[model samples]
Target: MYQLTFFLEEFLAQYWQKKPTIIKGGFKHFVDPISPDELAGLAMEEEVDSRYIAKKDDQWEVQHGPLTFDNTPEDNWSFIVQAANHWHEGAAQLVTPFRQLPGWLFDDLMISYSTPSGGVGPHIDQYDVFIVQGSGKRHWRVGEKRDDYEEEFRHSALRQIKGFEPIIDEVLETGDILYIPPGFPHDGYSVETSMSFSVGFRSPKKQELLSTFADFVISNDIGDVHYHNPLLSTRSCNGAISEQDYHDLETMMRSLLDNPHLLKQWMGEHLSQNRHELDIVPSDPEWSNEETYQCLMNGDSFNRISGLRAFYHDAQPEIIFINGGQYTLPDECADTAKQFCNEQVVTAKSLGNAIHHPAVLTLLTQLINLGYWYLVE
Candidate 1:
């Protein structure tokens, strides 16, 4: 496991989502967790989201994977695999240090292998990211956020911006990190063949939240209440919508948001979903609660699937959200629920006597059968 050398509090206060900064030697004597060849193999998997961006014939070219590197240019090309942490255990460890930030905000760990002079070009992301330098070196240029930065598409799938004045221009060696907040325009090219691990934090857009909330309301049938005026008043102009009518309608809609239960349910369900595919393979002959418990007692351990999102709201301690589903356990098992949500690996000793509880055992068995957690064979 990699440890961060910097102070989290200081970085959070000064740079997180506020400005861009480079932390030299963020991981002292860093060693890459995955190699370029491994990354290439991952890109060849059809279920993985991978891509190749290269400059060929003085024009930017983009190719969606499953990709082949045959006849690929030695220079001026990069291969990127999204959510590598989900499929690669070693790559997933890179995300552990960033858990200081909210887990729900995390999107995925994107690993990129670049050849010399290779880059995706100057572009702005809507989410914050920590680009960790691994293996060789990379020259990066980050600019201040601008309102008038014009977007120019080099390819149909590639969205880049016109060059901007650089506030930070530096070459990052292995173990160095570059932190860029949302809206900052930045570009990086490999000084040599290199690997970069980008841990991204996603911020949901207003429209996305509203649209999801609408879906939640519709699915739950919670906002079926209709507008009613018990005390009717005559209107001089019947064609025009009255201010009072507008206020009443708006209040009716906003009431859904005001309800704490509805808000918690929607937030839990929405945030628990992984932004990328999870490497889920359900147990071939599902284990029953008794069988799972017996295995645990016999010293078997369970590992939470990488990139599986599970969390609980403080307001509803008994309720746990896993992947897009919600479950309510007995209040006594709330701590166990929290443990399962927080821990990446759970051994029999770690769970203690909690595993003996019928409700907790059943829940764990169900989760294990669903392939969210697997026996460490």
Candidate 2:
């Protein structure tokens, strides 16, 4: 088991969201969690989401590869493989160290390789990412993510930066990690054959925010938010809209968006909950004291995913929340679970030792059977 160092805890507590950080050689016994071959295999599967982008001479180019790279040429190119960790358990372990951060805060794991002079060009991302340098060296130039749009060689759909000034410009080596916050512009190209692991977190898009807020509004069934203003008679010089009415419309829209309750739901769904939870469906539902007893007799362990997101309510730190549901545990169990929630993995024995309670054991059993909990035999 990897022990949480004082520095890791301190960094997360202080600069995680407030600022950026770069931790050199943070992982030891270090291995490339998954290789390019494995990523290619997963890409071949139709159900998976994968994409690749390349940087060539004075141009940023992209090619969609679902296993074959026939479209790609041989020189001065970078190859990006995305979400490798999502499909492969081995790759997922590399992410285990960052479990202290909430799962919702994570967007995806992207792996990339840049041959000499290959890079993504200078660009900014509107998200937070930890760029873990795996093998070889890469020179990085980063700047603050700006709102201005810069037209370049990019997908027509994407809004990207034109250019920016560097705030942190340096070369990254094996095991080194560079942290970039949202709105910060950064670019990296290879000094050699370099590999990088990017763990990202993103704010929900407008569509996502609006749709979720609408649901929140609906959930508040008793609220009097119905739009009801008597229509005025047509009395206009140009039959055009008046500034006051326009302002009123804008105000109403803002009011709906500004509602505290609505904001909370948006946060809960996209940030507080796990992205993987939507894909999960508990297997066995029927449980009894007898069944629980049998599991104990057989020494059967609970099933838990190493990536499961567990946390306590920010305000009510007493209430434990996981997979979009809330449950309260005994004081000891709550504290213990909180520790496990923020950790990569924990055993049933460890859990039992932490919180000696039948109910807690039962919950673990349910989670295990549901495949949300994992137990080592």
Candidate 3:
């Protein structure tokens, strides 16, 4: 487990979503969780999201990988592997401290290994991130939030901005954390061979939320309504959209918003949806309820699948959503279900009487067999 240097409540009240803050030695005696070689190996895997960005001959180049380093250059390049938590256990542990915050908002752990002078260039990110310097050092420059900026599209996939004054510029060493809020323009250049692990949080944009909601309504065959006015009013101009038209449309849109149940269900599923490939492997031979109970009694522990999204709403306490699906817990096991949602790891002792209950045992077996949770010694 990793410990945060500052009080989480203080940080949330002062800096979270408001401004950037640098915490020196966030983790005491920090060690690099994932090696550069391991990161490179992950980048070579087809399912992993990886990218290589470099400056070659005064021209910036970007390569989407499943990359092999056979012909790769030695310096001025970086390899970024996304969702390392899903693939590597050590990398996954990096998220432990940040889990003190809301779990549902977590994105993933992205680890990047860069050679000297390597960087992705100055760009604005739309989500919150805590960049932890894992090994070696990196000079990071973060500019204040800007309302006006012009892009210098160096590459089709990369949008970089130039001519911004930096507010925070420093070389971060091992264990140092730089918390960057959404819309903060920041960039980092490797001072030497280095690794940086970013624990990111998700904040959906208005456009994205609207698009997803539109899709949800369409998929569910709802939100279709025709305009109807009991008393038809004449408009001065035929070309102009009248106030009645605007009112009717606004009412139509409000119908969806007014349905709190539908909205909650949609939002739960949307937030639970996995953004990256999951590392799920169903049990080879499924366990029966008796076997699961026996294992629990024998001091077996349960571990949540890395990067799995599991959460419940207070209004709908019985239903727990995980990976875009919903499961309702029996009234007797509601406490245990809530515990599962709140924790990443569970021990038999923590469960107490719930482990022996039939419904809870069956649910545990199913979850374990489904690869969402696994029994561990």
Note the Cα lDDT for every prediction shown.
Answer: 0.92, 0.65, 0.87
Give the candidate number with the greatest TM-score: 1
Per-model TM-score on C-alpha atoms: 0.98, 0.71, 0.92
- Model 3 Cα displacement at 68 (Å)? 0.7
| Backbone-clash count (model 3) | 0
lDDT of 3 at 32: 90
Name the lDDT of candidate 1. Answer: 0.92
Q: What is the Cα-based lDDT of residue 80 in candidate 1?
A: 98
Q: Residue 91 in model 1: shift from native, Å? A: 0.5
Between which residue pairs do clashes occur in model 2? 143-185, 145-183, 145-184, 303-368, 303-373, 303-374, 304-372, 304-373, 304-374
Per-residue alpha-carbon lDDT of candidate 3 for residues 336-372, written as tens digits (9 for 90 to 100)? 8888788887778888888778878877788888999
For candidate 1, report its TM-score. 0.98
RMSD of each: 1.1, 5.5, 2.3
Q: Per-residue alpha-carbon lDDT of model 1 for 1-377, expressed as tens digits?
A: 79999988899999989999999999998999998889999999999999999997769989999999899988999999999999999999999999988889999999999999999999999999999999999999999998999999778898899799999999999999999999999999999999999999999999999999999889988878779999979888979998889999999988888998888889999999887998999988999999988889999999999999999998677899999999889998888889888898887898888878899889888999899999985
- lDDT winner among the candidates? 1
